[model samples]
Target: MDCTTVSLPFEMPADACNVHLHIIDPAFPNDGKAASQIGTVETYQALVNKLRLPRAVFVQAKPFALDNACLLDAIQKFGPDNARGIAVVNNTISDQGLEQLHNGGVRGLRFSVWNPDNAVVSFDDCAPLSERVKHLDWNMQLHMGAAQLVKWADIIRRLDCKVVIDHMGRLDPALGVKDPAYPFIQEMIDKGNTWVKLSGPYLNTKTGEPWEDATRTAVAIAEFAPERVVWGSDFPHVTEKIKPDEVVLTEMIATWLPTKKARQLALADNPKELYGFV
Candidate 1:
C-alpha cells in the first residue's frame, strides 16, 4: 500500500499573512508503530513546509490528553515566538497553571460538549471559568449542536469574556441555514460578544465530498456576522475517515465566501481581530 498522501494546492504563497496558525494537536497516536513514525519534529516541519511555513504557527495543545510538561516541551522545540496556543480546561485548571499558559501565549480555552470522552462544563462551572478568563481577557470557544443552542445562547450572554463558536456552532446539516438553532448563533453574533469559525464541513454536512450543504449555513453566518466570522483549516482531521483535503476545503470556502473583501475578512483580517494576531 502507498503511504504517500496528497497535499493542498501549492499556488498560494506562504507569506499570505501574519503566521497562519496550524492549531496543532500534540497527542500522538496510541499505536506505537504509527506514533513513533509521525508526530515528531521532522514530521511537523514537513507539514509546516506543506502549509507553506506560515509566518507564525500556533498549535492548540492536546490539553485533555497530554500533560502540560509535554506541551511545554513541544513549544520549546517549536519556536515559541512563532507560535501560540489554546488549551482545554474546566474548573480544575489551577490558577497558577492558567497564568502560566497565558504567559506562554495561549489566549483562549476550548470547551466541547460534543465529545463523549470530555466532561461537559455546566453553567455553575462555566461562570467561574468565564470569570477566570475575564481577568486575562481571553475568550472562550465552544463546540455544540442544535440541542445546546438555547443553553449556550444564555450562557454566552451572561459570560464576561467573548465567546467563539467552533465550526459555525457545529450546526446539523439537516437544519440548513434556516434552522431555529442557527438564529440563536446569529443572535449571539448580533449581541456582539461572539465569533464563529468557518471550519470543519463534517460537523455540518450530511453527505460526502463537496460539502455545499454547509454553504448556506456559512453564508448565513457571514451575512449575520461578517466582522466576527473567520476560517480555519481543521488539519489532520482526527478520527474522521471522510477527511477533507486542505486545498479542496480552501477552494470550497473561497466559493462559499466569494468576494475579495469577504475572503480577506474570512481568511486573514477577522482571525487577526478575534485571535489577536498582529
Candidate 2:
C-alpha cells in the first residue's frame, strides 16, 4: 500500500510518540547488515508529517550493529526535544560512552535474541548491561520470539531496570491469547516494570490488512495493562518484502485500546514517561 497517500481518520494527540522506528542513512558506514532500502531522516520526517506523530524513538537498526552513529545522528537532526533513542551496546562500553549515549537522548538499550547469528548482543549480556544502565534510568528493550520469551522469562523478571518488549513479544497470531507464552507475557506485565509495544502486527499475521488475528493479541495486552502499552509504526518495515500501509497500522490502535483515554496513555502519556521525553 502507498502509505504516503493515506491519512489518519482521527487526529493524534499533540504529544503522541512513535516509539519504534529506524533511521538508516547511507551517509553513515554500515557493517553490511543494514536494510536493503535506505531510510534517511528526511524519509522518516515525511512519514512523521503523514502520520502526524510529532515525537519518536529512533531505535538503532541492525545493519549498523554496534555503531550507533547513524541512529544518534538521526536523533540530533530530528531534534532531541521531539526524539529519543534506543541503542545497541555491550558490557564492554566505557562509562564515558554510556554517558555520551545518555546525553544523546538515548533512554534504552536493545538486546535481540531472535537472530543470534546476526545479533550484536546476546541474552547473556542483558542482565549486567541492564544493571550498568540502571542508574541512568535506561530501560532494557528486548526483541525475541515467543519461544525465546519463555526461555528468558526468569531473567526478564529479574532484570534491574524497566523492560520494553518489542513487537508484541513477537507472538504468533495463530495462537492468539492461547499461546503458551501468553502467561509469561502476563507475568511480565503484571510485574509493572514491563511494557508492550503494539507494533509489527504484519510480521505474525495470518490475516492481512486490518490484521484481526494479530489485533486480538494486542487487544488482550491493552486490556491487561492499558497504561503499560505504547504504539510504534515499525516504519520503513525493513523485514517485509511488501510494506504494510502505516495509516492502517496507526488506526489499529483504536481497535486495540478501544477508548480515547486508553489511546491517550498508549499514544502519548506512556511513551513520555517510558522514554523520559520532557
**How many pairs of residues collide in each model?**
3, 2
Question: For candidate 2, lDDT tens digit of each residue in 1-278?
Answer: 23363555565787889999999876788866454757888888877777778899999988888899998899999999999999998888999999999999999999977888878887788999888889999999999999999988888889978999998988878897788888988888888899999888887688976688888888888988998999998888988889886667887776887888888999999998899988
Which residue pairs overlap in candidate 2's backbone?
Answer: 33-63, 34-63
Best by TM-score: 2
- The 10-residue segment of model 1 with minimum total lDDT is 14-23
Which predicted model would earn the best lDDT? 2
Model 1 TM-score relative to the real fold: 0.80
> Candidate 1, after superposition: displacement of residue 179 in Å?
1.6
Candidate 1 per-residue lDDT, tens place, 1-278, comes to 22233353333332332222333333533223234222444445555565543433243434324234444545556666545465666688889989998887777776666664643444356667879878787777776776676655676678778887878776778777767677777777888888888777766888756777887778878876678887766655653665556557656655656676776676567656665666
Candidate 1 regions exceeding 4 Å error are 1-48, 51-63, 69-78, 120-124
Task: List TM-scores for all candidates, in order.
Answer: 0.80, 0.95
